[model samples]
Target: MLTATKMFMIVFTLLSIIKSVTLSACDEQEILDISDGELLPNGDVVFDGVVYENRDYFINNVTGIKTACPKLVINKCCPFGTGYKTRQCVNITDSFDAPVWDRYKLIEGARAREMFRFRIGKINCTRPYARVLVSQIGQLDWSDNWHLKSDGKLFVELDSSIPPWTVQPPDKYCIDTFVYEDQDGKTHTRLDALACFLDETPPNHFEVRSTCMLLSCAFILITVAVYAWLPELRNMHGRVLMAYLLCLFVGFILMASMQIMLTIDNITPHICVVLTIVIYFALESAFFWLNVMSFDIWWTFSGKGGMTSKKMSKRFCAYSLYAFGVPTILTIILTSLEFSGLPPHPLLPMVRYQGCFLFGRSKLLYLYGPMFFLCLANIVFFIMTALRIARIKHETEMLKSKESAMHDQHRKDKQRLLLYLKLFTVMGINWILEVISALYPDADYIWCFTDVYNVLIGVTIFIIFVCKRKIFRLIKKRIKENFTNSKNNSEELKYKRTIPTRLCEDSQHQRGSVETIRTTIGMENGVTAEANTTIL
Candidate 1:
C-alpha cells in the first residue's frame, strides 16, 4: 500500500539511524586500539586524548605539550580548567542548539552550556573537573590585567601603560580566554570563549558632564560679552582676556556637543575625528592666548619700552599670530600623521581608531605635551614678572615719588598680572586633574571632581574680572555719563527750538516796518513840496 514517497522516506530514515549509531561509536572511541607506543600509518601516535606529533612524542616523553606543540587536537571534556583546547577543528555533532560566531560556532555553543551550568549553580572550585573553561570569543587573547573579581565579574583595568587599541571595545561582543588543565596537572591549550565587556557606562555620566560643560560655556560667553561691552575692559589686557575666553568657549561647546552626540550614537567616525581636531585647535589656541597674557604682563613690568610701543596694534597682531599660528601647525601635523598610514603605535594620534576624541597615550602626547611646555613657560614668565614687580616697587619706594600717573599705571598692571596668575592656577589645576584621570581612568572620584571643576571655570573667571569693585564702579560711571549726556542733549535741543521761533517773529516785524517806511517815502515823493508841508 506504500507509494513511492513513502518508500523513499523509510529508506532515508534507516540510513540516518545507521549514520547516527556510527557517529556515536566514533565519539566514544575516536582512535583505534593498538599496542602501546605504536605509531599510526601517518607517523603520529594517539596517547590518551591528545595525538602526539610522532611515535617518540608520547605522554612520558612530552615535557610541556601546552607550549611545545603549535597545533592542538580538541577533546570532549569539562569546560573549565587550566588547559582547555580550542574546538576550531572539531565537528559539531551535539544537539546543544548553539548560535554561530564564524569560526567559533562549536566554542560558542559550549560556552552557552557552560554559562547555563554556572547560572544553575554548577560552578565548583573544589574539584579539578568542576572548573569550566568559559570564553565567548576565540580570536581575542587574554591579558594579565583581566581579573576575576570577588563578585564573579570580569574586570579589565586599562591604564596608560597599555596600548589603547588593544583594549578597544569589539563591535560584536567581549572576550576572556582561559587555559584548562586535567587532574594530572597537564595544561591544555583551550579555545578561548568570547563574551562582550559590559561597555555600559553610568547612566547619567555623559548627560551630567555635558550639562556642566554647557553651563560653563554660557558663563564664558557672558564674560566675553561683558568685556566687549565696557570700554574700560576693552584695553589691551581686556582684549587678550576676551580672546582667551572666546576660544575656551568654542572648545567647551564643541566638546560638549561631541560628547552628547557620542552618547546618543548620533555621530559617525569621520565626524568624531573632525570634531576632535577642531576642539584640539580651539583649546590649544586658548592656552596660547593665556600664554600671551602672561608674556604681555611680563613685558609691561620688564621695562620693555614696547609696552607703550608706537603701534600697539602691531603688538596685538604679533600675539594673534603666535596664538593662532602654532595651533594651526600642530593641527596640520596631527592630520598628516593620522592619514599617513603609519602602523599603530602608542604615540600615534589614532583619532579615528578611538571612535571619539583623543585618549590614553595619544591624548597625553598630543594634547598634554605642548600644553605642558606652554604651562611651564607661563610659570617662568610669572616668576620673572613677579621679580620685576618687586624691583619696581623697591625703586619707587626708594625714589619717594608721590603717586604719579605712571605709578598708578604700574599698579594697574600688577593687578592685571594677579588676575592672570589666578587664571593660570585654575586652568593648570584643572588640566592636571585631567591628565591624572586619563592615566587612571578607573578613578571615579577624580572624574566627579573634574566635572564639578569644569562648571566653575567660567564662573570663577567672571567673578575675578567682572565682579570687582573697580569694574562695578566703572560700569556705574559709564551708565551715569551716558544718562547725563542724554539729559543735556534734550535741554539744548529745547532751547535751540525756542530761539529759532523768537528770531523768526522779530524778523517778520522788522520787514513790516520797512515796508511801511517805503510806502511813506513813495507818498512823499508823489505829493512833492505842497503835501510835505501839510504833513509836518
Candidate 2:
C-alpha cells in the first residue's frame, strides 16, 4: 500500500506539471489575433504618402466610398491604441474629385475585397476635390464594419483628418470606440481594430472542460496527501479516504481529457467521461463499505457485535457487488445508449459539442448520487456507535456495586471497556464531522476545525496508549519504593523498642540465677556448721 501510494504521488506530480504547462500554453494561445494592425480583406490599401498632423484617418474601400469632403465632418475616437482613432463621417462632400481620391470598388464574384481607401491629390490638379461615396452594390461591403456596430453588424465611415486632408469618423459613429484627452488638452482618436474574420465558430468545449477537470484532479491530489501524511487518520480510514480521492482523481482526469479530445474533435472523449463517472460511483460505494469496517471495530469492542456483525457482513458483500459489478454494467448500458441515439441525457447525446460531459446534465448523477448514499451510510454508522457506547456505559454502572469476586473482575473489565469506548467515541465524532463536511462542500471551515479535533484526539490517544505503560511502571516503582521504605522504618522502630527491653530482661534473669546459686551454697555451709555443733 505504501509503495502504491508513493507511485501514485509521483504520477500525480508529473500530471500536475503537465497540466500547468498545458494551461499556460492555452492562456498564451487564447487571443486569436495579436498583431497591432487592423486585419482586412485582400483589397485593403496601406497608404504612405498621406500626411496627417495630429488627426487620424480610417477608410473603408470595399463599398466604393470616400468621405474627404470639407462639409463632411469627421470625428475620431480611439478604442484600443494611442496611435489610431475611430472616425465617423458627419456629412458628405458636394464636389466629387477623382485625382485627390483613390477608390477601390468591389468586383463581382470576387473572393476578397479591399478594406480601406485613402485620398492623394497632385499640386496642380484641375478639379481639386474630395468626395467619399457609399456604394450599395458590392460583393464585399467595407461600409458594413462589423467591429463598429452596436448589434455586432458591419458598418464603416471616414473619421479623422491630418494637415491637408484627414479622414475622420465621428465619436458617435461607432459605439465600441472611445476618445481620451492628454494633459496638454490634445485629443487622440482610438479605433477598434477589426479582428480577422475567420468564421463564426465556438471554442472547443472539450478544452474548457479539460481545464476544469485538471482543477478537480489537483484537489484530489491534495486530499490524497492529507490522508497519507496525517497520523490521526488510521489505516482503514486512510484506505477509504485514498479510495475516494483516487476515484475523484480518475473521474476528473477522464472528464478533462474528454473535453480536450472533444475540442480537438476526437471521438473517445465521451466514452472516457462516462466510464470515469461510473467508476467514481463504484468507488464511492466501496468507501461506505470501508466505513462499515470502521464501525464494526467499534461495535465489536462495545459488545454490540451480534446485530452489527450481521448488517456489516451483508453490507460488505453488497458493497463488493456495487463496487465491481455496478460500474461494469452501467458502462455497458451507457455506452450502448450513447450509440443508439437514446442517450440518458440530451446534453450527452451523440457526444457532440453540445453533448459533452461539461455541458451534460448527467453530471448531476456523478455529483450528487454517490454523495447521498455515502452520507447516509456514515450517519447510520455514527448512530450505531453512539448507541452502543451508551448501552455499555449503562451496563458498567449497573454492575459496579455487586459484592462478589466476579463483580470485582467485572468492574475492572468495565474500566478497560470504558477506556476503549471513550477512544472510539472520539473517533466516531471525527468521522461524523468528516461526513458532514463532505456532504456540504462549502463548509471548508468546518472541515478544517474537524482536522484540529482529529489531531487532538489522536495525540490524546497516543499519550494514553504509547506513554501509558511507562507512566504506570514509573508510578508502580515509586509506590513500591515508598512501601518498602515505610516497612523498613516500621521494622527499625519495632526493633529499637524490643531490643533494649529484651537486653534489660536478660540481665535481670542472669542476676536472679546468680542469687539462687549463692543462696544454695550458703545453706549448705550453714547445714555443715549445724552438723558439727551437734557432733560436739
Candidate 3:
C-alpha cells in the first residue's frame, strides 16, 4: 500500500510539471483569446494573424479592459501576390520572417500601452510589402496567418469594398497616381490631379473663353451708354461717373481674361501668365486713374481754387489724360517686354496651374508696389481737396455781406461746387474704405457692410442728381406763379378803394392828354436807357 501511494504522488507531481510547461508555452506565444463582438481599441479585435487598424475610432469613448487594449486586430493578411489558401489554420512561429518578429515586438509594446502603432517593411512572403499596424501583436498574428499554408502566403479580404480607381485614359493622364497610408494603417489610393485640365470638354473651354469676349462686349456697350447719356450724366457730375464706368468696364474685361486663363488645366505658358499679370496691372492702373479723377473733381469744386486764377479746368483735363495715359503706356511696354522675353523683364516659370501667379518675392514688388503708390496718391489728393473746399467756403462767406447780387451768384456757384464735391467725396470715401478693408480683411466687418452701402449710395446719387434738374424746374415754375398772383392781388386792393366821379372824369381827360405826352417821353427815355444799358 505504501509503494502504490508513492507512485501516485510521483505521477501527480509529473502532471503538475507538464501543466506548468504548457501554460508557459501559451504565454510565450502571446495567444490572445479575445471574444467576438468585443470592441477592442480602435473598434477592432485581435484574431488569428490579421492586424485590424481602426480608421474611425475615438479613443476617449472606450472603457474597461478594451481601453487597456488600445489597438486590436480585426483581420490578418499577407502582402500582395501571396498565394496562401485556407482561411483558419496557420503556424507562423518558427518560419516567420525577421520583419514579422520585429512587428511582434511592436505589438507587445502597444499591448502594454507604451506605443501607438507599428510599421514593418519587406517581409519575405509570396509578395512582400511594407505594412502599418495598430500593434506589433496584431502584425505577428498576420504573419502567422500568412504562413498557414505551405505556400507561405496569406490572403486578407478588405472589410469594405475597394473603390474602383479610374483615370482619364493614358492619353489624357497628365497627372500621376500615388499610394499613401493614413493614421489608421489603411492605404489610400489617389490620382495625382491639378486644379484644372488643359483638355477640358469643348463646352467648358468655350464657356471659359467666352467669358472674356462677353465682358469685352459689355464694356463696349457701357462705353456706348456713357457716350449717348453724357448730356444727362453731365448735370450730375458726369465726367467722374464716366471715368468710374470706364474703369469698371476695363476691370471686368481684364478680370475675365485672367480667370479664363487660370481655368485651363495645363496650358499656362509663361507668356500667358505674364500677360495676365500685365492685364492685372492695367486694371489696377485704371482703378487708380478713376480715383485720381475723383480727386481732381474734388479739388476743382471743393472751393480750393477760391478766386485764384489757376486755369483749373484745363489743368485738370490735361493732368487726367496724362495720369491715365502714362501708366497705360508703361504697363503696355512692361507687359510686352515680359511676354517677349526681353532683358530686364522677370522670367517666370510655368507651374501646376499652367502659369505662375503673383507669388514669392516678385509678388510684393509687382502687385503691392503700385497699390502702395495709389494709396499714397489718394491720401495726398483727398486731403488737399478737402482743405481747398474749406478755404473757398470761407472766402465766399466773407464776400456775401458786401454785395447782394454777387452773393447770389456766389451762392449758385457754391451750390454747383458743393454738388460736385459731394459726389467726389462719396467716391473717395468708398475707394479708401475698400482699400482699408482689403488690407485687414479678417479683423473687421465694416468692409462688407460699407461696400453694400456704397452701391446703394451710388444708385441713389444717380437717381437724385440725374432727375434733380426737372424737379427743380417744376418747383421754380410753381413758385413764380404763386409770387405773380400775390403781386396782382396787392395791386388790385390798392386800386379798388376811393375814386371821386367828377374829379375822376376831369382828371381822366387831362390825364389822357398828359399821358400821351408822358407816354411818348417815357417810351423814348425807356428805349434810350435800354440802348445805353445794352451798350454798356
Give the distance in Å from residue 520's predicted Cα in candidate 1 to where it truly belongs.
3.6
Question: How accurate locally is residue 56 in candidate 3, as Cα lDDT from 0 to 100?
Answer: 18
lDDT (10s digit) by residue, model 1, range 196-234: 333433254778889999999988998898788788778
What is the C-alpha RMSD, rounded to one decimal, of candidate 3? Answer: 21.5
What TM-score does prediction 1 earn? 0.64
Q: What is the TM-score of each candidate against the true structure?
A: 0.64, 0.30, 0.37
Best by the TM-score measure: 1
| Model 2, position 298: C-alpha lDDT score | 52
Name model 3 segments beyond 4 Å from true.
1-244, 257-278, 298-317, 329-365, 398-536
Local distance difference test scores for all models:
0.66, 0.43, 0.43
lDDT of 2 by residue, 122-196 (tens): 112122322222221121532342222212222333221001111223322322232446679896433333221
User: Is candidate 1 or 2 superior in TM-score?
Assistant: 1
Residue 180 in model 1: lDDT: 51
Candidate 2 vs. true structure, TM-score: 0.30
The local lDDT score (0 to 100) that residue 438 gets in candidate 1 is 88
lDDT of 3 at 372: 61
After superposition, candidate 2 runs with Cα above 4 Å error: 1-241, 256-319, 343-353, 358-360, 365-367, 397-536
Q: What is the lDDT of candidate 1?
A: 0.66
